[model samples]
Each structure stands twice: as C-alpha cells, then as structure tokens.
Target: SIPTSAGSESDAEQLQEEQHARSVLRETFLRCLLSISNKKVQFRMHEKVKVDATFGASDIDVLNFQVSDLHTPIGVQKEALIRCQDVISFTFDV
Candidate 1:
C-alpha cells in the first residue's frame, strides 16, 4: 500500500503544480492588460477589443478565456474592479 500512497501523493503534487501554473498565467494576463490600459493614448472607441488567453497542463488540462472590452470596461477608477473580475473569472473558470 505504500506504493499506492506514494502515487496518490504524486498526483496531488501534480495537481498543485498545474493549479500554480494556471494562477501564474492568469496573473500575467492581468498585468499585461493593466499595462496596455495605462498607455496615454486612448483605445479605439467602439472597437470589439477581444482578448484570448490559454493556460495548459501538458496535453490534458487546459483553460481558455476570451473576453471583450465591452464585457470588461477599463478606466481609472475601474482598474482595480476590472482586475479583480478578470482574476476571479479566470481563476474560477468562469
């Protein structure tokens, strides 16, 4: 049974690793969005503004996200709100 226990532990570790990777990918996406939104020039008005992101674990697990600017409005006061929403949505697979 020791070998079985070890296998279970390894599976847990792998899951943890995948979760961490996804978390990192989500964070990177949010940072990129913030940097882009902070640019001095205004984004094109009424543009579709689609953002696509993918996080994968080897060949099995994958998380894909596609968000439009219309769904997530970015502005001065809304920065934190937008980031929170994006992070939460990405983290929870929403």
Candidate 2:
C-alpha cells in the first residue's frame, strides 16, 4: 500500500503549481505577440515602416516577426503596400 504522507501531498501540489505557472506565462507571451502584430499592421498603413518583434521561451521556441511596407503609386495615385513575416526557431534551454 502507498503511504499517505504530508510530504508527498506537498510535492504533488508544488508540481501542479509549477505547471499552472508555466501555462499562464506561455499564454501571456502569446497575447503579447498578437498585440505586437496588430501594432505592426497599423504602422504599415501609414508609411514605409519596418519593425522587428521577438518573444517566447528560450527552450520552447523564439518567434521573430518582421514587418515592412512598400508603396507604389499608380499613375500619380496613392497606393498601399504591406508585408509581414513570422520566423520561429528553437533557441536555447530555459
């Protein structure tokens, strides 16, 4: 039979808390990325813009987003241009 000790229960609770913390951090990082993307889009609409936004856990993955805009006027008419790239890679251990 397994022993019902206070230490074991405490260990289990600690592990659960760690897992929850990791999950919350991951979610918050993702939300930050989304906000950065939106800001990049807004910047592109107005003028020629370039931005690099990077985020994420070291062991999991590193995300680098590059955004730019190129405007080409058509016969003296205003034009709009937008470009974005999301580059991701495994970086280092956490």
Candidate 3:
C-alpha cells in the first residue's frame, strides 16, 4: 500500500512517466547501434584499452558485441565478441 500524502501519488506517476521516456531513449540507442553494423568502429575500455573492430551486432540486452578483426596489443583477432560491460564507449564515422 502506498501512502497518498499531499500529491505523493502524482509524484509517483511523474516518476513512472520519466522512466518510460528513458526506456524509449534506450531503445533508440540500441537501434542506432544496429544501424551501424558492419562498420569500422573504435572502442574504449578499461585499463585505457583502445582498439578498432568491425561492428557486427549486439545482443538484445546489449550484453556482448559480435565483432571481427579486433585489433589488440598482441595481434588482430579474426573474430571476437566484446563484452559491453567492458566498453566505455564506441565511435564510427557517419
């Protein structure tokens, strides 16, 4: 049971609306990622790791990214799956 004290319920409704807006924004971001498929992108991760790879696709939950030709210190991997949690951000040319 929720207490309705001086417009508290309205405050809760406003919070719910804000959450829905955030969800829509997140879906839009995921769609943007999909639109950038097969493009060369640069990723920045922890430990100041920066590498380039061909963007394939990300899981529905944005957990992991399927990529190819992952450039690393040792060598470039022919195929790779980068964990999204490890990535700070990524960028590619429009």
The candidate maximizing lDDT is: 3
The predicted structure with the larger TM-score, 2 or 3, is 3
RMSD of each: 12.0, 11.8, 3.2
Q: Could you tally the backbone clashes for each prediction?
A: 0, 0, 0
Q: lDDT of all the models against the reference?
A: 0.39, 0.41, 0.93
lDDT of 1 by residue, 1-94 (tens): 3454446777889999999999999878675544443222222223444322232111112232222322324432312122222232222122
Query: At residue 44, what lDDT does model 2 achieve?
Result: 29
Q: In angstroms, how far off is 22's CA in candidate 3?
A: 3.3
lDDT of 3 by residue, 1-94 (tens): 6656666778989989999999999989987987889999999999989999999998888899999999999999999999999999999987
Write down the lDDT that model 2 would get.
0.41
Compute the lDDT of residue 34 as modeled in candidate 3.
Answer: 77
Candidate 1: regions farther than 4 A off: 1-7, 38-94
User: How many pairs in model 1 have backbone atoms within 3 A of each other, for residues 3 or more apart or on separate chains, i.e. clashes?
Assistant: 0
Clash list (residue pairs), candidate 3: none
**Ten-residue region with minimum lDDT total, candidate 3:** 1-10
RMSD (CA, Å), candidate 3 to true, equals 3.2
